[model samples]
Target: MVSLREREAELANETQTLQTAADLFDASVSEAANLGQSSASVLVALQGRVDAAPLATAEASRLNLLQVAAAAQPVSIPTYQRASIDEKDLVDVGKAIDGVRLARESLPPLVTDVRDARSTVTAALTSFRGELSNLGSAIESEAAKAVTINDSASQSFRAAVTDAAARVKAAQQAGGDGLAEMPVYAASLDALRTENARILALEQAERDAAPTTPRNPGSGSNTGGGTNSGGGSNTGGGNQGGSPDTGTNPDPAPSQPAPDPDPEPVPDPTESEEPPIIIDPEPAPSGTVPGATS
Candidate 1:
C-alpha cells in the first residue's frame, strides 16, 4: 500500500509541471503575433510614404534643369577645366574640406603631379639664384683680370718706347762721332754728310776756276760801256792801255805806263772838221785774249 501511494503522488507532480509549460508556450505565441502585427503596420506606413513623396519628380526636374543649362552654356560635363572657384567656397571651412577630399579622391595623380612640379620649380629657382650669385663673382674676377692686363700693356708700351728712344739717341751720337762700327742709321747719316761736303767743295772749285772779265779800260763803271779806252779792272785797279790776258785773273799786276805820243800839228779850224777818233776796246771773248787799243 505505501509503494502504490508514492506512485500516485509522482503522477500528480508531473501533471502540474505539464500545465505550467503549456501556459509559457501560449504567452510566447501571443507575443510573437503582436510583434508580427506591429512590423506589418510599420511596413505599410513606409510604403505609403514612398508612394506619396515627390523625390523622383524633383530629381527629374533637377536633371532637366542641368540639361537646359548645358544646352545654353554649351559646355562639356566631367571636364578637367574650371573657369573659377567661388570665394565663398574657398573661404568656407566645410566647403574647403569637402573640396580637398573630393580632389584627393578623384585626382590623386594630378595632385601628385602638381606637388612634383612645384618641387621642380622650387629647385630650378634655387639653382638659378645660385648661378646668378656665381655670375656676379665671375664678372668681378674677369673685370679685375682685364684691369691687370690693361695696366701691364700700358707699362710694356712705355718701356718699349723708352728703350727705343735710348737706342735712337745712341745711334745718332755714334754717327756724329764718325765711328766706323756705328749702327746702320749712324752710317747712313755719315754718308749723307760726306756727300754734302763733297758737293759743296765741287761747287766752290767751279766758282774759283771760272774766268772773270775786265771792265772798260777808261771808265770807272764796271758794267756799262764807255768811249774811254782806259777803264777799271775787276780788282778795282786803274785801267791799262790794252786788254788783259785770258786767264783766271781778270787783271794782271800793274806795269810801267806807256809814254804819250807826240802831239800832231794843229790843223786850221776851217780846213779840218773831222771828229777825233776815240778807241774803246770790246769785251773779251770767253777763254780768248783781248787786243790792245790806242
Candidate 2:
C-alpha cells in the first residue's frame, strides 16, 4: 500500500489538473468584451472606403460581419494528464485525464455559442435604435397636431366674442326694450350680470371667511364710506340718527300705536221703572237743619 504522504501528494496533483481544465473551459465559453467590437469596427471602416456607399451595400457589410462572427471557432486549450508514478496513483491520474479531455472537446461548441450570442446582441441594438428614431418622429407629429388644434380653437373663441359684442351694440342703438330688439343678446347680458353678481357674492364671502387684523387698533370704529353715506341719506335725513327705532322704520304713520276702543255705554237709569228718592238714615236732630245729618 502507498504511504499516506504519497496519496496526499497524488491528490494535490489531481486537484490542480482539474482546476486547469475548468479554467480552460470557462475561457472558451465566455466571450471577451472586445470580441464583437473588432467586427463592428471593420464594418464601420468599410463604410468610409466608398464615397457614400449604397444602403444595400452597407447593410450587406454589416450582415457579412455578423455571419463571420457566428462562424468563428475557438482554439482548443492543450491539457496534460497527471503522471501516475505507481499503481497506487492510477485512480487520480485517470480522473485528471478524463476531465482535461472533456474540457478540450467542449471548447469548439462553446466558442460557437459565444460568437452567435454576440452577433444577436449587435443586431438587437441596431433594431432598437431604428425604432427609437421612429418613435421620436411620431411624437413630434402629434405635438404639431396639438398646436394646430389649439390655434383653431383660439380663433373660433375670438370670432364668437366679436360677433356677440357687435350684436349687443346694435341692440343698444335701437333704443327700444333691449329684449325686444335682441332677445338672445338680452338674455346673454342678463346671464352675464347674474354671473357677475354671483362672483361678487362669492368674493365677499371669501373675504369675510379670511382672517383679518385691525390696522389701527387705537382708532375708533369706522363704517365703510359708501355704505354709511347711502344709508344715512335714505333714513329721512341725518337728524333722525339718534332714534334706533325710527331709522329702520321710516313710515311714522304705521309706527304709532292704535287708540283704545271706547267703553260700552251705561244703561239709562231714568228709563227704568224706578223713581229716585233720597235716602235718610235717621230723623234730623232737634233744632238741626232739615238737610243736615246727625
Top lDDT prediction, candidate number: 2
lDDT of 1 by residue, 149-179 (tens): 3342334333333343344344434532111
Whole-model lDDT, candidate 1?
A: 0.38
Q: How much does each candidate deviate from the true structure in C-alpha RMSD?
A: 47.2, 29.8
Candidate lDDT scores, in order, read 0.38, 0.43
In angstroms, give how far residue 153 of model 2 lies from its true place. Answer: 3.9
State the displacement of the C-alpha of residue 147, model 2, in Å, after optimal TM-score superposition: 0.9
What is residue 247's positional error in candidate 2, in angstroms? 58
